[model samples]
Target: MSLRTLAVVGTGLIGTSVALAARRQGVTVYLSDRDESAARTAEDLGAGRAAPPPEPVDLAVVAVPPSLVAPVLAESQARRLALSYTDVASVKSRTEREILATAPDPTRYVGSHPMAGREWSGPRAARAELFRERTWVLTPTRLTSKRAFDRTLDLIALCGAVPRVMGARAHDEAVALTSHAPHLVASLMAARLRDGSAEAAHLAGQGLRDVTRIARGDSRLWSDILESNAAAVAEILTRLQEDLTGVLAALHDLASPGPAVPGGTGPGGGGVVPVPGRHALVDLLDRGIAGVGGLDGAGGGRRGAPGRPEAPAFPVAGGR
Candidate 1:
């Protein structure tokens, strides 16, 4: 059955976006937020009504930060706010564990994360088509009731997202590699530009802009995300550090002087010299090109590539 009604517990970007999308599909949405003004803003934007529903909703979406998901879901469940509950927080394992421990009816809850959003946040940044063609991960435990799972899938469908079911631990680890770690890497790279020379800043082009786009996100919220998924994020960052050390060493070698090339004219007619680590530099560049090419057109992984598994289709509720 289609989702007829939903109650969004936090009217931030994701929450408001969900409400807007559901409202577009003729679903009744009730918006609420701890910051009452935010909820009102969403209501004014035509996402939904700011007032509480007269009866329990079909689903309740807790679209808060990872740290708040458990408590908020528990409270909503205790109040009988909805027949089913789901959260749109990035990290899943910690929130799932907390829900199991604290929620009044853990069987009614499912964990979800929409692989969508802009760097800009708040209810004002929301749009009904924000989730179109995007991945919406559903992490359902063995204790999740079939009815609740199906209702969550109906919510995903209404939002125009493809659903993919995974275990909470697996989802956490996957996102840490793809999303969480990348955000930290982007922020660290962007941090270097803060004290850069004016000329350097002026010469910046789309490459730097693209890499640092997500660095403009809310730091407090990102801090909570990093903390919640620290272990998985740390593992990925450690591997990145190892790669960085090798690249730095290669760059140093490339900058060092080497034996002069016979009969070669250098700049200003001086004898030309070869740089050390030419082979290493070339290899690194080649690898970078290959890695980037792999990410293009096929999303992240290359399909049918040797030693790489084909990308899995987004799983629907009962079947795809």
Candidate 2:
């Protein structure tokens, strides 16, 4: 089958990036976005033509917010805009459920999440290489057609993303701890700076920058993401809270200098006679800070670095 065109129903960062990538591969694209100006902008950038379906396309990519994925797919399928559909929503379970509950036949659709993004957003932030080398998840139910699956996977490969297959629930659960929870934690921490002292804000460095990067994402989009994976995110947050409490308790002991602070004991000499949890927490945090500094293949404390005395070579993941 000679596939010629793709219908991109959203023109935000991911959508525009998809258009740019597909067009670069010599595929024709049809563009649509609620924001007319944004849609026009993407077209002007040579992403695609700002036109509705001149004829039913092979695949439709609904690259809207997490909340709109299902509804948009249902409406698009209902109107017969594309023979098959897929989405680029970050969270997958709720959207998949919504698709099953709404679409006439969910078989014509696939739920996908690309594990890639940037702190910046919108069409201007769109880059054809956005998904390069990233893992793109495809959650296809038993009802999904082979044609749809093949077509969607083709698009994923064309985008330079490696396809990882998993159930929708598994996808959502994994991203909850790895992506969603981290975003919430970052936002909550950045919230502290809403009224923080100027000196503190100015002195902020990569530590705060890395943590708060996702905090700058579209709040409305994240609200939808957090809600969809609330159960899993809640579980992760509970564990994180437990860790945070440990860190705080440790700080309290040292700040007030319970009783000379040695021997891993607290004020009442009841801290932790052996294997102190507080001291362990401090050591873990120190290790984490040091490990992060070793990012970019650069090592610190060449003599006594926490992670490994000797650097593990550059780009451990890709052998860069």
By lDDT, the best candidate is 1
lDDT of 1 by residue, 37-104 (tens): 99999999999999888999999999999999999998888789999999999999999888898889
lDDT of 2 by residue, 155-266 (tens): 9888988888999988888788668988998999999888889888789999889778889988887798888789999998998788787788776765763455355534
TM-score, each model?
Answer: 0.87, 0.83
Predicted structure 2, TM vs. truth: 0.83
Q: Model 2 residue 245 lDDT?
A: 79
Off by over 4 Å in 1: 257-276, 299-320
* CA lDDT, every model vs. true structure: 0.87, 0.82
Q: Note the residue pairs that clash in candidate 2.
A: none
Candidate 2 displacement at residue 229 in angstroms: 1.3
